[model samples]
Target: MAGLFGSATLGIGGGTLSDLFRAQYRGKAVAIYSWSPILAPLVGAVLGGFISQNTTWRWTFYASSLLSIVIQLSGLIFLEVTYPPLLLRRKKARQAKATGADDLYTEYDHLDEGRVQVLSTNLFRPFKLLATQPIIQILALYNAYFYGNIYILYANYIDLWTNVYGEFIEIAGLNYIAIAIGSSIAAECCTLINYAIFRKLSSRNGGTGVPEFRVPIMLPATLFFK
Candidate 1:
């Protein structure tokens, strides 16, 4: 009933970006971090098309399973605990255990709530926000429209290339390279533009930081989407 796997994946990714990058570089770090997951599927589309054309489709599943296994093992072995609150809780528990103290605890230990409460809040948050905030509703609708068009393109791409353009399946997959290139360019451009705006805002605020600096970057993005 619950998506534990998806939750863990997002937690690890978001935690990694927060723990690994400085505040000034965080925007770029987040941009690059977000790019990988989307790029992987685009890359897979290109590879899958070629593989299915030349070899058995079974090989695609085989390769995917192998990659997933490797990533899982690597995560289990190599990933460090990046969440500060979790780390502090573990440290406090170790110290308390060593000292035989019942009262010693980390701040996070006291903030705990029932799992059901947490799940319910997270589940309802999107709907609540969409209902309450017109801006969020508009943004959600725009993103849904954009991604829906992308899915439509993915569905029809093979037919367009193979039937309309008279290209082979393997050759048709190369068309995805254009999408990949455009994504990379757009991501880099946005990263640079966002950082530039953030720097100016930070300067105008006498080097004090606020999240409002990030909102202007959306103007360019909205224009691009138009």
Candidate 2:
């Protein structure tokens, strides 16, 4: 259930960062944001191993639920509305209530053209990109393969160690820590490198930045070597 919702809305955080940050800093901000979802599962697996070995499997879920509650509470208290369209809509709503005006609207209100249109647009967007953009299709396929490998590893990793290598389950899970550490270091490097390259490219284009400027750094990073 968590995986279903997480995968469905994974793009929302990136979209939110795009709304909050300027173009020059947006890529770097999103890189930092992207690291969390990728790191969480890896780190969780390591913790799950120790918890499962010492306690029951149910305790692993209990720990997860407790941590999720903490995170949601923190977000409720500290997270502010950052998306401009949504912020404007919220402001308009408050003004309408206070002024007794039912006709108040925001610039983005045109987008609320019934639930059906909005749902269709959102649902078809990825397919539209895949249809029109060859690069997007290639990237999608590549990521599909890459994540497939990671999922397979997660399923068989402890079994391989505990059965073949005769390692304790707690020790077997420690291997995921190495992957988590490596990915963290890489994300930091990529964020800095991506920002630096974006700055240099934007400067060359008569002080105007193009989205294409992001592609060079992105391509190498896609290869996971940058």
Candidate 3:
């Protein structure tokens, strides 16, 4: 359930950033946003092992709960409604209240009664793309393979280091630093390459972005991985 909620939050956050950012910066912003998930487990395993060994396993839950509370509070305090339709609807309501008129309505408020069906379709649209979109299918396949191996390694690292190397659990955890370092370097390199490709492609397209602009770089990168 925790992983499910966390993944859902990440998906929603990515969607929100897509809406919030301009086309040119969206790729870079998303790259940076996505770095956390790749990097966190590498860092967390070391720290979590250290804490669990020195203190108690319960502290992990406490720490996670505290961190969640802090983030939730910060979001509640610092974030504002960024969706344009929602903001406009709120403004319309305020205006109506002040002017004593019921006529004010945002475009969303005027949407058809069948909008519930439209919303349901929108919710299922991602699943539809997952099933049918070849590009999405390919990328999802690669991501699943890559992260699956990383997580498999994450789970078994302790056994590998402990039984094989006769290292303490905390010391065994230090092996995760190698994964963290490699991930950081790859992320930085990808960010730079992505930025360079996006700029060049945007210029070549006369400043209008084409989704295909991002594909060329990936081909070489994937081949290099091969």
Clashes of each: 0, 0, 0
Which runs in model 2 stand beyond 4 Å of their true positions?
96-105, 131-133, 218-226
Which candidate's lDDT is highest? 2
Query: Model 2: per-residue lDDT, tens digit, 180-204?
Result: 8887888788778877788899999
- Candidate 1 clashes: the total is 0
Q: What ranking emerges by lDDT with the best candidate at the front? A: 2, 3, 1
lDDT of 1: 0.80
Candidate closest to the true structure, highest TM-score: 3
Predictions ranked by TM-score, top down? 3, 1, 2
Error at 98, model 1, angstroms: 2.1
**TM-score of every candidate relative to the true structure:** 0.80, 0.80, 0.82
The window of 10 residues in a row where model 3 has the poorest summed lDDT is 106-115
lDDT of 3 by residue, 1-226 (tens): 7886688777778778877998788877877776787787777788877888889999877877788799889989997767777678779989989999988777787653476898898789989999999989999999887778768878997889989989988899999999888877888788678877888889988998877877777777667766
Instruction: Point out the worst 10-residue segment of candidate 1 by lDDT.
Output: 1-10
Checking candidate 1 for backbone clashes, the offending pairs are none
lDDT for each residue of candidate 1 in 46-73, tens digit (9 for 90 to 100): 8888888889999888877788799889
lDDT of 2: 0.83
The candidate, 1 or 3, that scores higher on lDDT is 3
